[model samples]
Target: MALGGGTFTTMNKILPGTYINFVSAPRASAALSDRGIAAMPAEFDWGPEGAVFAVESGEFEKRSLELFGYPYTHEKLKGLRDLFRNIRKGYFYRLNTGGEPAKNDFATALHPGTRGNSLRIVIEAAEASTEETPVYDVSTWMDDTRIDLQTVKTAAQLHDNAFVRFQAEATLAATAGANLTGGTDGAAGDAAYQTFLDQIEPYTFHALGCLSDKPAVKALFTAFTKRMRDESGVKFQTVLHRYGQADYEGVISVENGLTGAADDTSAVWWTTGAQAGCAVNKSLTNRVYDGEFEIDTRYTQAQLEEGIQSGGFLLHRVGDETRVLTDINTFVSATEERSSDFGSNQTIRVLDQIGNDIAALFNTKYNGQVPNDAAGRVSLWNDIVRHHQQLQTLRAIQTFEPENVTVEAGDTKKSVVVTDRVTPVNAMEQLYMVCVVA
Candidate 1:
């Protein structure tokens, strides 16, 4: 029999050369994860179809044309621009894929949408090439701006650019320019939004945005969020418009919408990003709205207070600037398991951070690697305490006690039971100062 050199699970083998298991106990493994990510499922006239793509803030400005099929300043990207103002990274899904891609004799547009119709290809004869082996200069343009330039001897030598894919079998020809045509956007229905929700489930984001104003669509997003947060342990908040009936900590209901030409759009996009980008120790209450939308903020003081009682996340004009009325979610009813403090978004963020961080610490440091022994349980307890100390120092949580956390073997040998408690901190939202007459 061959010598058993691999790691041992039960240590029962008779003939074993070396049965060793490697486990990591790095201190850095328990560090808290960053939280500036958001997810959005929206209809785009142009972009990838049937996929979730990540867009980084650092590259959104430079790669706007390539990624979204529009320039950075285009009106089509106004909502995304507002969203990106706060978030660092976003996972976006283009919910429409029912259109035909534009195509010409030389190449086809990379994606389907009306924007592809603006793509044009220009081919010119190079100066230093023989008639038998002619060289050509190809320029890819979106209207007046040339996006890609290539020099090729034949169609076979051309490769796909950002805007279009080359036709390797077509003969090269020189003309003014060939514009891509016949691009169309397929209609986006409920099924498309469902597809987006199904695909975006695996991603970890702090906030999700529902841009649709339809009640049914909002309800779909609301249900999906509750299932993910309650059943799957995925911690995040979903921002919706005019749907306070969700009444869940995982949902933020935007009561006020904007007017003007962008009536369909609302502050939900900005709030989604803001809620995601907000630090766990901070709050968005009274935060000024610095977005591009002309928000509807004509509510009176009584209306604002009433909206808060109804768990409405609304905005109102304070002086000349619009500010958030309250940083809260649609969590009106309190249960035995949850209290009114859960309505505060800052409190929610801290709780979410602790849950996510401790889970990460356990999964990365102790899961499957550490044996279910007293020593292993103690090691896990220490790491959890250290992580909580960091949170306490950061003011995300207050007065964390290491003795409050307990780790023990679960009902089975493969299971580890951990019980932890955290008191999340909330920012001040009210003032009750009185003046004494002298």
Candidate 2:
């Protein structure tokens, strides 16, 4: 039935059901440190009705599935309904493995039934601003959150295991005084040489670097660090774009950061955000907007050699090793193959309890006790059957409508002209009440 000329909204709700996890054979590895991996559990969050509500803003959050309100058996109904919906959205279907037309199908060389189904239908639902607000009952701000064609994995593991690094170089233009030779236009040039010597006098005699020579090394290292930072930024941005396009959004945290080292005349000074022997450059770690991000090691052979050769470098082994692991939650197509066909044939035995009622009516109304003889009883049974069939046929005819066809209307603005006409009632010799013709 179609309702006309108004915004028609439907609220489909699926009642919640208990969820169970089955691990047929559970196993764990001792060598995998203290960390462990587990499969993402399947969930069912049905609302008041049979419709499955989308998960919002929590651990599972956007990583939930959506289902229709109708109670569908695994085989006959759910798949068929999904197929029909796809067809309505212009997705031409082909037969799948079990000989049913599927929306997500392609004819591959090896398996001619597989295809990439990317067509989507965007529904405008209302999102809840708070827990008290009813989301399913509204019609604005809600977006589709289900991930498609991706596998699920945990992001916490990735944050722990991913590598990261940081480095920086000097801004020489801002640093104070080295040689300002080109600034002055002096005579003979000896005075300029003398001025240079005076400027170098402050630290020229020091064991490592005169204060004047320090700027050169700082500038080089700073530039190098800046380049590394830029590269890291680009790589992270690319990952964010890809994940967002795939409909995955989450926070990314990097651990164990690296701040660039400084080179001195006698040794290299690696900036340690933490104290000596603690993790260095830890503050470089940050919470990123993408689902995945990385941390890395930053070092240069030339810088290391320069520090070692100058007797400032100390050789010490890294006593502790921190392992990193990464995980991601992606959406992938899964089938619930509990039974090839889920529906069963039901036999509905509807015995008529109308015998007494019919007999009584006949006895009272027709002034008959209802004959008890075999032939008479047989005739009564036939009469009952005839009445039942007539009522059924009348009902069917009342409810069923033939396909519509266009017809001309002479004067009426609205009229229903059914092509298959019903017999008109003849009133010429019918009940005659006292009446006057206008």
Candidate 3:
């Protein structure tokens, strides 16, 4: 059997769990894994409802209308544009799906949202249509742009497309256009966000963001993150707005607000994307804010310092541009088991990478397939060592030694026990120098 795949609590156990190793503080951190995936529940004018939909970074600009029911530059997609600026791929769940779909006599909108109101269907005789054989050209248009065109002899031949579902039983008629109406966006409530969490549980992402400013909603995300990380061994941090009181490593509380928008909590989206996309070797400290929203970086020097001490992920004005004050998660209360290093998001990234990668390797390569013998153990050891070596080369970890890893048979012949060590590296954030005058 594979390891239970979670942090070790007690040595006494009927079932094997995460391996533990004790070493002196003097010595030195995981696989090399890819990053840049983020997840969040978003409110949209039009999109898939009640399920998570994936959007690639490159697809946002070109296929924006098809995927999201709006052009790339549409005002409704501003938040998505801000998020996709950093993330490679995003798992988005539409929080509002209870609205009625816009419909005319001939067709109905595919999804329920206000954007569907812009849809119009134009039907006319095709060039091939003659007295002997008649066919009509049916076209779906969003504003002035003709998106889909189909030639069919009768309405019965019509089928549902991405944008709309045709009325198969309606008689074919030629008209200027029939605009879909009555479309409306549903209100997102606490239950909608809860539905998002339930649906997104199986997805693998580097970061998750809570766009809601409600204390109850933020608390829900915090609890979900902690459960996923500690119990399920799913490693990812949740970004929150003004939720530093969470005091958990699995959460990054954004201290600053946003400008030019009614919702100040929207800035959390940018940080979520940035944190997810950041390399395992890197940190967001002092990184320039290139997102569309203007962050409120108004804070005195002492306040900024105090913010860091309290584990607030803040942005500050640097020259004419805004930049991150320092990269940190809301884990101010560090204990012996979990050291102060865990407070740094960079450190957590490295550690999470290790836990995730090693668990994946064990589950895929060694679980049930390999015998718990000496040769199999050596092979497992080799793979882990190579994974750590790659991370060390990437500077995500430092001073990694292959000998630090030890793999052995567990109490049962079907199980295995492995204990490893790693030293995670953090980005340089501060420097001090002394000038001597002779």
Candidate 4:
């Protein structure tokens, strides 16, 4: 619908992580109507899937048909739908194995075309203006940041079952081999240990970042640092920080790796020396590593909240019954009243009110209210839980990783591993980052 006035413009847009707003004062026009239908609209709702506008118009009605007495319809922003659709699908961190352009990998692999990698918006005035309704416009653009395969691989390693086992076995083997005397002969255990390390080479993390924002970056840094501290098994001080400016700046790094012998080369040699870095490390916490992700930073606080709210992306293990976390923030926030029969009952009631479609899926509800039975023996309830988790992951990535980098060149050397600040659960869109001892 059109808002009537002498001649004016105002608009606002909300991108994934940022918001932009604009307005124009009423202008003076030579032509004036005695009954000038001046209107200012505040907001408009178009259902759940439709775009809602909270506008302040000079002359408009919330449900006005036409100020000029002609039929009118609001202009549908095709780009908005396109952008939101991509956001809903979320971004992926695919291992660019083909050696093509990484940007192309990101652009093409994550749903080719239609503003998937980056976003651009424009706000411009249409025609003449005066003192009263001065022409006005507003525009904004938001994009997702990108990291390298190493980052994704490393982060994934934290959750990788096989990789964790391999690292554990390798650490023990290396330790045992170190105690063995003489070069006369190496036992099978030594060989096996070395093999384990070799196998781990391809799965190592080499880069790190928020995958989009500083907060995400901080969360990952905190999580990994804590994990390393708990598992490093070494006794040494630790430190991490950033340096530099402009495009050339990156994270600083310095950490020691454990060695089997004194004369042997240092096992922990990583990017060190203040080189305008993002994070740092000192001493080798533990050459041996385990699988544990942490979230202890204000930056990651929202992320952790989002991650938890997103429903954990996947139901790792589901039995006949599962404790589905309806609201992770509330669940975690609670001290003694997190999960209540009353609360659970209320939630199920709301779901039931919505329809039997949902109620049919859940049986044996947690509070003895909602059903907990898996329909038709297919575990439909569990499936729905898993779906919500995936949805949560997608939403988290979209909300937190709006500042993703788009690596256009996918060549091997050009594909320098970087850290993904955010981790989308999607296999392809998941950000891969490396931790270069930084």
lDDT (10s digit) by residue, model 2, range 66-109? 22111333221232232222111111111112211112111101
Candidate with the larger TM-score of 1 and 2: 1
Question: Sort by TM-score, best first: what order?
Answer: 1, 3, 4, 2
Candidate 3 C-alpha lDDT tens digits along 1-438? 675654456676566666666656521123466899999898888888888999899998899998999889987787888888899999999898689899999999999989899999999999999877888999999998899999999988987888999998888778899999999998888999889999999999999998898999999999999999999999999999988899999999998886655348878888999999998889998899888877888899999989989999999998999999889999998889988898999999999888888888888877788888999888888888888888889899989999989988889888778888899998888789899999
Regions more than 4 Å wrong, model 2? 1-123, 127-272, 275-315, 318-438
What's the TM for model 2? 0.12
Q: On lDDT, who's better, 1 or 2? A: 1
Mind giving the per-residue lDDT tens digits that candidate 4 earns over 1-438?
Answer: 343333223333223233334556532211110110111111111111111122122222322221111112323322122112111111112111112111211111111212222322222342443445444222222222111111111111322220011121221100101111111111222223223223322221222211112334333434443343235421111112221111011121111112332221111111111011111111111111211111112223354334443222111112322211221111122236333321121232222221222222232322244233333222332333343333334342233332232212224422222222322221121357987995
Q: Model 2, 335: alpha-carbon shift in Å?
A: 77
What is the clash tally of candidate 3?
Answer: 4
TM-score for candidate 4, residues paired by index = 0.13
TM-score for each candidate, following the candidate numbering: 0.92, 0.12, 0.90, 0.13
lDDT of each: 0.89, 0.20, 0.88, 0.22
The better-scoring model by TM-score among 1 and 3 is 1
RMSD (Cα, Å) for all candidates, in order, is 3.9, 41.3, 9.8, 33.2
Mark the 10 consecutive residues where model 3 has the least summed lDDT.
23-32
